[model samples]
Target: MKGIVFLGERRLALVEVNDPTPGDGEVVVEIKASGMCGSDLHPYRALQDLSRPPESRVIGGHEPSGIVAAVGRGVPRHVALVGDRVMVHHYHGCTVCRHCRTGWPQLCEPITRTTYSANAHGAHAPYMKVSADTLVPLHDSLSFEAGAAIACGTGTAWGGLERLQPRGDETIAVFGQGPVGLSATLLASTRGSRVIAIDLDDDRLAMARQFGADETINAREANVAEVLRELTGGQGVEMVVETSGSPQAAAAGLQAIAVWGKVCMVGIGGKVTVDTQAMLDRQITVMTSYTMSTVAQKSCADFVVSRNLDLDRLFTHRWRLDQAEDAYRVFDAQVSGKGAFIF
Candidate 1:
């Protein structure tokens, strides 16, 4: 099996390794497509800082899609059978936790959940071992690349938008034009909500229009809050989805919405400073979220298929497993859009 391992200085290598075998209640998947997530860079950036290498090597991909190669004893046949196409939910929780009991195992209390690329082996390899419980069925109509995207970017956006519940009568300002933000723009528009997409790059903003943004604002060119204010007739939009994770954008997005508006933050970045007095005066509702659960993962795939969304457009770059290093290099440099490694 061929896999990627990070060796500091933002470098990675393709190495030959033994194939993974399924553990009890687990499955070994032959990975077909794996998404290169923005969040994957966090570990790579800090791996060298540790006194000693944490694991054999750092493997950083989380969004995984594949065909089941083998299933372990006690695994549910109906859920993950050999040769079945599926996406693996990156988060693996302690099944007995309260949060896991609620179907959102990813948010287990006391944080006993283990995720890909952090503590466990990730899907950047040709084969990955995952819990059968984390498998989500991939419809024949959806491509492997799209299934991989659902593992993270698309799933995160879908879950956040579903929580915000954008309506036709409402207007939403999606603060970012990256994969997650673009997904938000497309979903919000398909739901009939007027969408205003914001970004610092002209190219991303242009792509946002392709995703169904009614208005585009380059944060570098103009005041984001001011532009959004004018677009909404001074009352401001009813909703704001901040996927940039920029501290300034975070604060501006929350303050740009109409009184009592809803704001959902999906991006994980610098700290954001908020005004308590202003928040109280406006009675704002702010929510911070991450990836969806395994159940929600299935629902998100269905949501994309039901809307007939072009998840393909989000994947602007694709490479083979051997090209892993170059893929992450450009992605980390912010020179690429949603990317994937096809086996």
Candidate 2:
């Protein structure tokens, strides 16, 4: 089989590798579509959070949708039969942990899970092996690309919305117009909430408007708090999802919410210096969101189908497996919208 490997220092290469054979309680999937995400940039830059050294050469895809080609020993029949389409939960954790028991394998208690493109073999190849429990059925109606997204971008957005539980009566502010941010906008709007989107890029801002943002703010040009305050009619938006790790956006998201409002942080990293006094006085709620739990992933897929969301519009670029290098270069530049590698 052939797969993509991160050679460190912003380098990626498609290399030949042994075909995956599932172990006990595992399944091997013939990948049909795999997504390139912001998190993949970490390994590309040699950040080393989860990726192993150059010698081991871990594969570099986390979100994938594919057909079941083989089931390992002890694999359950109810999960999927041969030829069934499915999405694998990117996080592979030790099942014994309390977190894993709740279907949040990404938050592995002692951190024993094998993360894609880091410690374990990822899906940017012809075949990938995953534990049976991580499998989530992909409805026959949804495209493989959409199924792939459910494990990462879409799933992360759903996780934030599930936790925040935005109501139609409230206004939502989503910071950052990345894939996760766009998903938040689309989902909140579909739920009938008035949404305000914040981002520096005009292209992303435009995309946000199409996704149902009532107003768009370019943080580079205006004070987000002021604009948000103005848009909400002096009463700040009740719910805010900050997907931009920028300290400025993070601080503004908290400050622009109404008293007792909730702020959900879905960005991966960076620090925000909070106003201790203001936070205490406002009776605010702030949640630091991680990746979606396994339950959340399934729920997101169901919701997407039920609502008939047009997420296919968000994906702007698609490359073949041979074009791995070009794919990351464009995605790393962040000039283009969401991109994927299609089989």
Candidate 3:
């Protein structure tokens, strides 16, 4: 088998590797779709080498969806059967932990936690082996690519929106129009909130408009705080979801937020200093959301199925596993909607 490996410094390659086999309590999934997430850029653009320390040399993809190819010993048919379509949660931890039992293995207390594409083998290849517990059934109505999106990027956006709890009569300003941010815009708009999408790129702003952003702001052309205030009739939006991970955007969100409004930070990036006095005076709430839990992942899938959201439209590019290098080369530009490796 061959898998994509990150060599760091904006370089990657498809390298040959041993074929995966299910171990005890694990299952091997024949990869159908593997999503490329923005977080992948962190390791891709970093100076540090991710291809070292043997274990860290794992395949590069965390958002995985596929069919069960094989199941290990003691794996019951009820847990997973060959040919069952599934979406992987991508994290494994000691099942005894409170977090793990609650379906948040990413927050497991044990050091034995395994994160696919980070410390364990992932679905960047033809086959990926994961703990059976991480499997979430993919609804028959949804495509594998949709399941892949719900596995991570879309799920992360859903998690953030769940935190913000935007209402139909309120307004929300979503910072950044990347995949996660775009998902937030789509979900928030469907929830009836007047959405104001902010991004540095007009292309993404246009994409946001298609996703139902009531208004768009080009951060580079206009002062985001000023535009947001003006758009909201000088009061500012009731909710802000910052997905750019830009300190400047975060600061601007705070500056332009309405008093008592809520802010949810979804992007993963640099630190942003908050004005404690301002927050205290405004009595607003600020919180950060990670990816969704296994239960939430299922709920997101259900929501997508119910809403008939054209999540497959989120993909602007799709390639075979062998095109990993070129696929990422284009994705790294950060201008495209989303990319995936379709098996």
Q: Evaluated with lDDT, which candidate comes out highest? A: 3
Off by over 4 Å in 2: 47-55
- Candidate 1 C-alpha error for residue 192, in Å: 0.9
- TM-score of each model, paired residue for residue: 0.96, 0.96, 0.97
Residue 200 lDDT in candidate 1: 88
Candidate 1, residues 1-343, lDDT tens digits: the string is 7778676668677767678889899999899999988776766565465455434774668889999999999997798889999998988888888788766877888788878777788899889998887888998889999999998998988889878877677999998888889888988898899999999888888899988999999888899898889998899889988887888898789778799999998988668888889889988899977778777888889988998887988999999887777788888876457999998
Runs of candidate 1 with Cα error greater than 4 angstroms are: 50-55
lDDT of each: 0.84, 0.87, 0.91
Compose the digit string of candidate 2's lDDT tens values, residues 1-343. Answer: 7889887577877777789988899999999989888788866877543444444687889998999999988987998678989998988789988999999888898989878767888889989988888899998888898988887988889999998987678899999988889989999999999999999989999999999999999988999999999998898989999986778889999889898899998987669888878988888899988879888898899999999987788799989999888888888886557888888
- Ranked by lDDT from best down, the candidates are 3, 2, 1
Model 2 residue 251 CA deviation (Å) reads 1.4
Displacement of residue 334 (Cα, Å) in model 1 is 1.7
* Cα RMSD, each candidate: 1.6, 2.0, 1.5
Instruction: For candidate 3, report its TM-score.
Output: 0.97
Instruction: Give the count of colliding residue pairs in each prediction.
Output: 0, 2, 0
Candidate 2 local Cα displacement, residue 102, angstroms: 1.5
Q: Write out the backbone clash pairs for model 3.
A: none
